[model samples]
Target: MFLQNVFTSYIFLVLGLFHVCHAQHITTSLEGRLAFPNKTPFNITTKITLNSGEYTTYSRKDGSFIIYDVPPGVHQLDIDSKAYHFGQIKIQLLEESMDSPKCLEYAYPGAPKRVVKYPLVIYAKGTYEYFETKKGVSIFGMLKNPMVLMMLFSVGMMVIMPKLMEGMDPEEKARMKQQMEAQKDPTQMFSQMFGELTGSSEDQTAAGTTRRERREQRRVKNQ
Candidate 1:
């Protein structure tokens, strides 16, 4: 019984260590083609650096390359070939497992080409991913989903509704604009809505009186 207990504890310890190691280390492939300054793809020698250290890989006949078994961290990669220009990128490793290899293409001047750059930053809490293309557009990959689209739609409606309603009569347009502005603050919106719903002219009169009294008080105080 004592030997069995010891074996069980040892097995558990080994399994725990394995799980921790699995969680800490990650492996992913980087696959992309290399192109010359003239926008022609060619076979190239690729060097990937992890954490500023020298790492090496090779591109296939089609100028495609893959780097596997990359640990979780920031990596600086360089791709070079005798026939093509050199390209460099910075990558962040965060996911426990990744299968989709990043694809990078080259761009040259005088010819419209797509240049892809992936710069990933990993934080303790999460990872931030961004990409820049030769077309002068930067994309944040994490926020490019449907939920963000819905949020943008809601905000667009909130901004455009007041302008659309402004085509009504002057008095109605002014009232709607005031209502929209008042909704910007929850406390002000609640107070105004309550006053309007209850037909409370007392609050309005009190507000006017308070303003006038404050002006008089300020004048007297200044005197």
Candidate 2:
């Protein structure tokens, strides 16, 4: 019974030692703020990787950031911003004492960038207008011109209306086609109307009868 009691005490002692060593390797935290070239604070996302693990965090509008449980070693820090570009940087972390905290401040090296530039003109009248005119009628011109827009709309309707009328009855479609064709022949309709209004129909008929009578007389004379 004494031997068994001694063995149990040894087991408990080993467990306590292991717990102490584990406590010594406990996690550490790093806190910091991000800044710009002009010392302006902006919201940003950051990705950090170290031998311990990978972590991601976002800085608030005030540019404050905090990362927890980072191992003491070399790490990679990446700042995420499309307009403001940043390359990866190597970060060094030191072992944190139980009484002290690791705090840092970081600044993004990127600044504001312009993507487009307009041409400069000086001492030349109409030079810009001349260059624009050389490019000739663009799609914007067609869109803005009422006559061109009307023609485009008419052509579009011509293409779409046939398909729409396909679902219509054949008799209705035919009648519509006839009416459109008549409307298209404005000159012929106008001539018929003028002839009726001025009695030109009677004049033309009388003229034709006289020519036939004259032709008959000439035939008789020739015989």
Candidate 3:
């Protein structure tokens, strides 16, 4: 009985060590390539990361990269490039080295699985907007603003309509005058009745809308 108990204990110890050793050797290499648009300038310092900062690798001059000894599990593979942006991909690897690799959409996890070829073919989305665009208030940009356009329209109507009304007879001129006064600019009327719906003000609502505006939105849903 004593000899049998020793043998049983020895077996369990051996199995535990074997399991640990096997898990340690289960790592595989993650491979992928970085591609950019034709004639797009790219720096040679592009790097790839897995599971945030668990494992990191840099791409070669020819845009090829590999993360060595990646442990078998799910990982978020991402590229780090200053001038460009790349898609975040979800990669899953199993214990079997023969298990083929696939890229899944990391951003939309609940969406359908998007399986792509192994040795991932990563493409550039576009360049990052590093600097704020120069805002010197050009005539074209100001004209695009709702407030500016409304003001210009109201001024033009006030100036031109009065002189044009001079040619009309008394009844016609009075009718035209009433129509002009009654038909206030819809934009101006909304601003006065509800509140400022647009433009950048320091105390403006974070959503660019007020509680009343949201109620108005829900009201307009039937329309």
Candidate 4:
């Protein structure tokens, strides 16, 4: 019976030591909610950093926070907002657990206090945006079209014709100047142009007829 009593005492002594060690290792935690003025826990983000062990945590979407395993002592609680201005606060943690939520409220600066005002940003459609919507055809489609080739050829002629005239000999320049003067009278110019075309056609016909006649005469002599 004495041996059984001693065994029971040893078991109770071991359990007591376990309890004491668990209580000594108990850690403290901080819970809080951050909010902006006249708002219910805005979606703004908040950063909390405890100087001890450099522990840190960001606030939830509802502006709630829970920092675990905080060292129990006087520590600097550095607080920062992603969209507001609430400086830091010093926290004195003396308890193993804090169930009451720490509530913090901050206000944004007034419009007059805003020194760096950002300009309004906007996007405008370009003038050529409509052409882009046509799907490749409106932009480079003309490059492959016959009309574009004709237009380019006409423009090239217009550019080269003046340079050609400038480089002509003095006699050719005189002739060209006379032609320009003739062009001043549109009626006379059209009449003269038509006469020249008909005269050249007649001369070609006459030369072809003379050649045929010579061939006929040669055949007769051979026969």
lDDT of the structure predicted as candidate 1: 0.59
Error of 3 at 183 (Å): 28
> Could you estimate the TM-score for every candidate?
0.35, 0.33, 0.55, 0.33
Question: Which model scores highest in TM-score?
Answer: 3
- Candidate 3 — worst ten consecutive residues by lDDT sum? 200-209
What's the CA error at residue 113 for candidate 1, in Å?
18
Q: TM-score of the candidate numbered 2?
A: 0.33
Lowest summed lDDT across 10 adjacent residues in model 4 is found at: 116-125
Question: Per-model C-alpha lDDT, please?
Answer: 0.59, 0.57, 0.76, 0.60
* CA error at residue 114 for candidate 3, angstroms: 2.7
Off by over 4 Å in 2: 1-25, 43-53, 96-223
List, in order, the clash count of every candidate structure: 0, 0, 0, 0
- Model 1 misplacement above 4 A: 1-15, 43-54, 80-84, 100-223
Of 1 and 3, the candidate ranking higher by TM-score: 3
Predicted candidate 4 versus true structure: per-residue lDDT over 54-170, tens digit per residue: 889987777777778765566555555444545344455455433332322212333222111111011111122224444555647777899998999879977887898988986
Ranking by TM-score: 3, 1, 2, 4
Best by lDDT: 3
RMSD for each of the candidates: 23.1, 18.5, 20.3, 17.6
**Residue 35 local lDDT, model 2:** 52
**Candidate 3 ranges beyond 4 A from true positions:** 37-43, 107-113, 132-223
lDDT of 2 by residue, 8-106 (tens): 999999999997877667766655555555555455554433333477766566656666776666565555544454434445555655224322223
